[model samples]
Target: MKLLIGNRNYSSWSMRPWLVLAHFEIPFEDEVLLLSGDGWRETLAARSPTGKVPVLIDGALVVPETIAIIEYLADLYPDKPIWPADLQQRALARAASAEMHSAFLGLRGHAPMNLRANHAGKVSADAVGQDLHRVETLWGQLLARSGGPFLFGAFTAADAMFAPLATRIRTYGLPVSDTSTAYVEAIYGLPAFQEWLALALKEPWIVDDDEIDVIQGRVARGTLA
Candidate 1:
């Protein structure tokens, strides 16, 4: 299998399925497609049905979208515990992952994941406060129920779905409860996430659209080095 991903520093969507594949010891090769450059969109279009990052290519099958890729992986490896074994738990996990896919626009808009940079206190609370509250509530309920270092008491695909949100919470210095803070720390401590983070820090490409400083006019678009 070959997974085509965008730059590690800025591609939150790409991070989700990659973590699941890596953490589960799945045998796969990855190719990094720089998200910027002349004709990059055309390149993505040619390679992906949705013209997006994180497309999974397994022989003749191509899986696009993070959740879809994760579901496909879960189906491929039922013994791997990608989702919880219990039917109810699996349902909850899928629900949460789907919610992650569609909701939280405010936080997503204001706090793009950038593992290589920190813009502490620069994000306005008003812009993301409602979404933060929802995150805290949802996470708190799950953690309290599961007694987790992760949502389901182990690192499942549901946790993979929220891993980038964890980065956003930390990178933006967003205030979350002790529970959520611990959850974020747990995500950072995952061996797979650490491997991704290490590579992200080494990346030279910058997507200005995702850079808070560039969007806020604090840094010129092409000046980051």
Candidate 2:
């Protein structure tokens, strides 16, 4: 199996599956397509039908989307227990992951992921507030149900799905409750997340638009206070 990812500094979508693969100690070849210049487009086009980063190629199989890649991994390695053991818990985890995959457009658009940025005081759209509220509600519900350290008592697919959101919340200094804040901290402190951050800090390829956005005060930085 081979996993194709994008530039570590700016590709939140790419981080999702990469983190999962890393966390589970999956041994696979990595192909990083730097998301600048012309190389990424050509490489992506050849590898993915959707021409996106974070495509997982397993011999004859090609999984393009991050969620699909995660699902594929879960199916292939059920012993790893990426999802919860309980049927109801597994269902809820899937629902949360799906929600994260499809919704939260407002937050995603307003505050693009930039791990190195430190803009301390920026605000996003009204819809972003709505998205945050929904996220907090979901977090509270899941944590209440499973009593985390993680979304489902242990790090599962649901946690992987929302990991980037935790990064976004931190990057933009978005408001979150005590429970949500703790959850974000837990995610940030994960070994996989720390590894990703370390790689991101060393990366040379910076998206100029994202850098400009950070400098221009379009995106807030630092963790939620």
Candidate 3:
């Protein structure tokens, strides 16, 4: 299987399935498609059905979209505990993942997942407060229910789904509950996540659209030193 991803520094969607594949020790190769620069959109359009990263290519089957790729991984590796073993818990996890797929626009918009930059106190609380409240409530409920270092007590696909959110929380200095903070730390501590972070820090490419400082006029594009 070959997973086509975007730049590690800025592609939140790419991070999800890559974490799953790496965490589960699944045998697969990953190819990086630069998310910006000349004709990058055309490149993605030609390669992906949805013109997005995190596309899973397994033989003739092509899976686009983050949640779909994760579902495919879970189906392909049922024994690997991609989702919780309990049926109800699995349903809840899927629900949360779906919410992550659709909701949280306020936070996501104000705080794009730039792993390299630290823009603490830059994002206005008013802009993302409601979204952060929802995230805290959801994370708190699940962590309490699971008694977790992760959402479901183990690093499931649900955690992978929200992994970039965890990065955003820290990168933007978003206020969250203690439970959420610990969960964020747990995500950062994961071996798979650590691997991704190390690669992200090393990446030279920058997506100005995702860079809060660049967008806010605090810094010139491509001038990060």
Instruction: Give me the runs in candidate 2 sitting further than 4 Å from their true place.
Output: 125-127, 212-225
lDDT tens digits by residue: candidate 1, 1-225: 999999998899999999999999999999998899899999999999999989999999999999989999999998999999999998999999999999999988989999987789999998999999998999999899899999999999999999999999999999888999999999999999999999999988879999999988999998887
Q: Which candidate number has the best TM-score?
A: 1
Query: Which candidate model has the greater lDDT, 1 or 3?
Result: 1
What's the number of clashes in each of the models?
Answer: 0, 1, 0
Colliding pairs, model 2: 119-221
Clashing pairs in 3: none
- Please give the lDDT score for candidate 3: 0.92
Q: How big is the positional error of residue 177 in model 1, measured in Å on the Cα after superposition?
A: 0.6
State the number of backbone clashes in model 2. 1
Local accuracy of candidate 3 as per-residue lDDT tens digits, 1-225: 999999999999999999999999999999999998899999999999988888999999999988888888888888899999999999999999999999999988889999998888999999999999999999999999999999999999999999999999899888888888999999999999999999999988878889898888988987865
Winning candidate number (lDDT)? 1
Go through the candidates in order and give each one's C-alpha lDDT.
0.94, 0.84, 0.92
Residue 34 of model 1: what lDDT?
82
